[model samples]
Target: MTALAVTITHEPARTILTLDGELDMVSSARLTDTIDAALYGGRQHLVVDVSNLTFCDSAGIWALLRAERTVSAAGGTLELANVQGILKRVLDLTGAARAFRIITPGQLTSP
Candidate 1:
């Protein structure tokens, strides 16, 4: 199983969280914590860069959904970037893609 790593960076208008490795039940909490930190840090726009994400299970999807809910509740927006491979297929097949504001790397410019 690939280990999960979440790296967070603060930008002028948003917070970017780059997720690498696997996101399963064991690592979902870490993602949640990172999301909470970014939101509480007073960021209204969150960009989750999943380019390095290698794997994701149902729990991972749940974690992303939960983050979305939390961000929306705080009047912020959550966007998913660079979703590809199996992760992209999972989101598409599950119709969860519509739940997030999906963007390409080219669109993730400073706002």
Candidate 2:
């Protein structure tokens, strides 16, 4: 299994976290830590780019949901970008897609 990798980029108005590898139970904490750090740093808008993510399990989905809730409760917004293939299918299958603000990569570049 590929190890989980997370790269965080801070933009003027938002923070973007690019996730690669498997987002399973073992790697969920990294995501959670990244989310906490971003929010704690006063970032209100967070964009999680999962275009390079190789795999995602139920734990990953739960982590995403938890991050969304945390951001929302803090009066912030969390968006998932470049979500495709299996990850997208998983979200659809779980009926959890509607709960998030999904966007394309182009949207992130727009002013």
Candidate 3:
């Protein structure tokens, strides 16, 4: 399994997490930790750019849901950008896509 890489980019009103590689059971915790850190830093608008994400399992989906919940609880928002491939299918099939604000690739700007 390819290791998950999360890159953080901070903007004026949001924090972007660019994910690459595989997001599975092994790496979901790390994703959560990164989200927590961003929230702790007073970032209310969170975007997860999954353009480079190679894989994602249920655990990864759970982590994302948890992040969304946490952000909402803090009166914030969590968005998913550049979603495609198998990851997109999984989210759609599982109906998890309904829980997130999915941004199309063309609308993506800097984090």
In order of appearance, the predictions have TM-scores of 0.94, 0.94, 0.93
lDDT of 3 by residue, 1-111 (tens): 459989999889788899988888999888889988988989999999999988888888998999999999989999999999898999999999999999987766854
Can you write out model 1's per-residue Cα lDDT over 48-91, one digit (the tens) per residue? 99999888999999999999999999999999998888989999
Tens-digit lDDT track for model 2 on 12-111?
Answer: 9899999989998889999999998898999989999999998899999999999999999989999999999989998999899998999998997847
lDDT (0 to 1) per candidate = 0.90, 0.92, 0.89
In angstroms, the error of model 1 at 62 is: 0.6
All candidates: CA RMSD in angstroms? 1.4, 1.2, 1.5
Pairs that collide in candidate 1 are: none
**Model 3, residue 95: what's the lDDT?**
97
Residue 22 accuracy (lDDT) in model 1: 89
Q: What is the lDDT of residue 10 in candidate 3?
A: 89
- Considering every candidate listed, which one attains the maximal lDDT? 2
Model 1, position 97: C-alpha lDDT score: 96
Worst 10 residues of 2 by lDDT: 1-10
